[model samples]
Target: MKIAVLKESGGEPRVAAIPETVKKFVGLGASVVIEAGAGQGAAISDADFEAAGASLASRADALTGADFILGINGPEPASLAGARSGTRLVAALDPFRRRSDIEAYSAAGLEALAMEWMPRITRAQSMDILSSQSNLAGYKAVVDGASLYGRAFPMMMTAAGTVSPARVFVMGVGVAGLQAIATAKRLGAQVSATDVRSATKEQIQSLGAKPIFVENAAGIEGEGQGGYAGETSEEYRRAQAELVSGHLAKQDIVVTTALIPGKPAPRLISDQQIASMRPGSVIVDLAASAGGNVEGTVDGQTVERHGVKIVGASNLAATLASDASALFARNLFNFLSAYWDKEQGGPVLPDEDEIVKAIRVTHGGRIVSERLAA
Candidate 1:
């Protein structure tokens, strides 16, 4: 079996497969070919892949006779011109907004597996790209916000006056939010967090951050399918907004990490509330790519409003390309290895398997994912 690792386009720095994963695939009796310079963005070289038993070739040459294709992002259909029909294209295929791409994959008779749609079940934890990438993004959000803030994170006292610690507020207590809270606290900042799920109150406290929850508020039970935050009622939103409006005014740094699966990110901060914060305060919106939690955020750019900086931290994990690539590649490897069939000489995805059911987006020349079908 042949596996092709394609270099990412559109300025994405992370690569899907690393030398470690290429070596693992080789051990599984698969011949691995990497497109030339595929890992350059992650500081890896062709020599490194060659040492791991992977051949470097051009994109067209790499796709020739390939049975499986690996990528950090889904390749444009036009780029897969050389690949044969029924080739399994594995990646974090953003199936929702990229519906046309999914259809194109179906038309091309390729089997598309969306790694991002991996289920939240314990068995699939190691294969979860979202959790792995979001963890890094969360850490970066806090560090980036701290850098943009004019004052120091920790309190300082010397012969002169004392400088108080920065106050950090985190919205959404998911993987990213929790990490952001922990990072801010480690930096000696006083941190607080809020989430639609009341269960996260203890999680926030465990991370040494205060929980800002609305008491006795109805419709705050936002535990969605697949462990994502569900939408709340209008009544609950108003109550939470009032509470957040007051808390946000005093925060020096804010990191918003709330995201609903296949939906636009919830707006956690308003322009009016942003104006209340002191000058030079920083806000990092991790959901900036999903239309932002802050009003003035522009994905991939940092903008200032009312003298406060709003960083549109879209794909913050990509900034740490080396580590992110390693973790992502491992996730892909774990997934394939789990389904590897020694007799078949390649991974076998059973139709009824829970994981296969969850991630298989296109198979048999049709868009088959129930998540998208629904």
Candidate 2:
């Protein structure tokens, strides 16, 4: 097996995967080929990969001969237009919205693995791409939000005077929200949060933050299935809006981290809520691409509304690309290892295997994954 690491085409700042890890694949009898200068943003050099026994080649020659390909993002069709058949591609692909891209890979007989579709289970934790990446995004969202706020995050006394602590409100209590709460608490902020699930209140309090329990939240409790949140009813949404309205006035910064699998993120904030915040308050919306939690958030752009800064982070992981790439590389390695049968010298698609069965998109020129087809 020959694995190729193509240069990430966009200015995404993340490498497809690290070469040091690929060296492990090489030691397992797979030849590793990386495009020259492919690991630039991740702070990896060609010499480093060469030391790991990877052959540095041009994109064309590498893709032409590689049996398996890996990337941090999607494959650009221009760079892979004429790739040879049987190139196994694995990455965090947006398979459903980009159906044409999946079709192209299928037409070329490429086995596609959508890392984002990996099941969220205890055994699959090592291979969960969404969790690995969202952890960074969650931490980054706070760092980004704190930078925009006028006041300090933590409180200090006796120095130039007494400094007050900032108040942080987290809208979602999932992986990203939990991280945001942890970061905010570490920064000395008076952190508080709310969620559709009432069960998360204890989890929020465990992180040293007060949980702002919404009134009548029973309507939305336990809506999560498979570690993901399900849609709430309109009655729940209206009641939530009324409950969240009062919390906004006191918050120095607000972070929203809600997301729905395969659907646009639910609207948790309205225009009237934005009007209640102070002038220097900031809202860091992690769900900007899926519409937004803050009203008037433009994806990948920042704008001010009612004197408040709404930060819409398009690719939060790209901000810390080097570390992000390293974490993502580890998850990708764990996932690939599950299917990699070293004794047999090829990937083994174990039927009904938890991790492999969850993310397998197109195998043998057909969409084998039910999550992608339906």
Candidate 3:
């Protein structure tokens, strides 16, 4: 089997395959071909992949007669012109926003699988790219917020005076938010978190952070399908907003990580709330890529509003390219290895498999995912 690893476009620093993973695939009797400079952004050299038994070639040369194509992001269809029909392309394809690209992939007869859509089942944990990446993003969010904040994270009692610790409020209690809470607490900040799903209150407390929850609010059970937070009623939103407004005024640093799968991120903070916060306070919005939980987020840019600094961190994991690449490469390896057909010398994804159903976006010259069909 020939596996082709393509370079990501659009300034994406993370690569899909690392040297360690390349070596593993070689052990599985697959010939790996990587595009030249494919791993450069992640500090991986062509020599590194070569040492692991992979050949480095130009993009078109690498794609020629390849059975499987791996990437961090979906490659443009035009860039994949040389690949033969039935070449399976796997990546975080972002099918919702990139519908036109999905169509192009279908027209090209490439089977497209979106790794981000992997289900939250117990068996798929190691294969989950979203969870692995978000864990890093959460830690980065707290660290970034602390760097931007004027006050110290921990209390310091010097001879002159005692500097109180900064107060950090996390709006969302998913993997990212939990990590932010833990990171803030480790930095000795007074950390607190809130989530629409009340079950996460215990999770917040377990991480040594306080949970701020609105009681007696209808539609508070926001736990959605697939372990994601679902949409809530307007009544719950109003109540939560009122509670968070009071809390925001006292926070020195805030990190927002609220997101609904296949929907816009829930707005957790408003302009008025920002105005209420003290000057020099910082907020890191992890949901900036999905329209943000804060009002004035600019996707990848930091913007200031009402004397508060807002860091719109779209892809924080990309900033830690080396480790992120390692983890992401492992995710792909774990997924393919699980379904490997030793005799065929390749992975054979059964059409009826639950995982196949969830992540497969385009197959057999058409859109196939039920989520997309819906």
Candidate 4:
């Protein structure tokens, strides 16, 4: 099978296939073709891919007659215009939100697989793109927040006086939130975290961070399918707000990573909450791309309101392109390897495989994912 790695046009710095994984694809008995500048953003040169046995081709030539196309993001309409029927395309395509893109895939007679829909099963953990990307975003959030803050992260005793360590509060203790807490703690900041799921409290405490919970969290359940946080009631939001408001006033940095898949990010910090924070405080909202968790956050921009810095860092993982691309490429390789049929010399989607059923957004010229079909 011929596998083409297309250049990402979504302004994302990360590429779907890196040199390390390209070699693996070659080992799997697949001819790998990569766009000339596909790996440029990730500090990889055309020579690097060539060394991995991947032929360098132009964007148009790369996708033409390819059996499987790999990318970091969904392809543009123009790129897919020439895709042949039964061509397999895989990427972190946000099919749930980008319904039109899925339709485009079907219209082009392409079989689309969305990496974001990788089932959160023990067997599928290696292919979890969401967790891999969010882990990088969480670490970047702390680094960005620390750069914005005026004081030091760790407490220092100088000739002048003793400076206390910065206090960091991480909201939504998911993969991203947990990484944020870990990153902040490593920088010598006193970290604390909160989550809608009461079970995450143990995870927070395990990392040596205090776990804050809402007063009315007794009846509210945030754990959803695949252990992701589900949508919460307005009453639960109110209780969460009340609990967080007090902590907001004392925090030097706040990193919000709360997100409900396929829905707008829940607002965790209001304008009033921003106003209550001390001057020069920093807030890094990892959920900025999904309507923001902080009130003043503007996606892809850093803005100051009431003397507090609110950073809406979109595509944080892309900023660490080299490492991000490496991890993401490995994830794609793992997913593809699992379904690769040695006898058929192509990927075989088993009907009964839970991971395959969840991720196969459009197959055989139809939108096949049950969730997206709805």
Report the lDDT of model 4 for residue 138. Answer: 94
Q: Estimate each model's TM-score.
A: 0.98, 0.96, 0.99, 0.97
lDDT of each prediction vs. the true structure? 0.93, 0.83, 0.93, 0.89
lDDT of 3 by residue, 1-374 (tens): 99999999999999999999999999999999999999999999999999999999999899999999999999988999899989999999999999999999999999999999999999999999999999999999998888888678999999999999999999988889988998999999999999999788889999999889989795446456787888888888889999999999999999999998788998889999999999999999999999999999989999999899999998999999999999999999999999999998989999999998999999999999889888
Comparing 2 and 4 on TM-score, the stronger one: 4
Model 3 clash number = 0
Off by over 4 Å in 3: 219-222
- Decide which is better by TM-score, 2 or 3: 3
**Model 2, residue 288: C-alpha shift (Å):** 1.0
In model 3, what is the error at residue 236, expressed in angstroms? 0.8
Q: Residue 204 deviation, candidate 1, in Å?
A: 0.5
Angstrom error of the Cα, residue 330, model 1: value is: 0.2
Collision pairs in model 4: none
Backbone collisions counted per model: 0, 1, 0, 0
Candidates sorted on TM-score, descending: 3, 1, 4, 2
Q: What RMSD does each model have against the real structure?
A: 1.0, 1.6, 0.9, 1.3
- Residue lDDT tens for model 2, 128-162: 87887889899999999988886888888975799
Query: For model 4, how does the per-residue alpha-carbon lDDT over 28-131 read when each residue is reduced to its tens digit?
Result: 89999998998899999999999989999887788888999998998875676556899988898888678898898888889889999888889999999998
* Candidate 4, superposed: residue stretches over 4 Å from native: 219-222
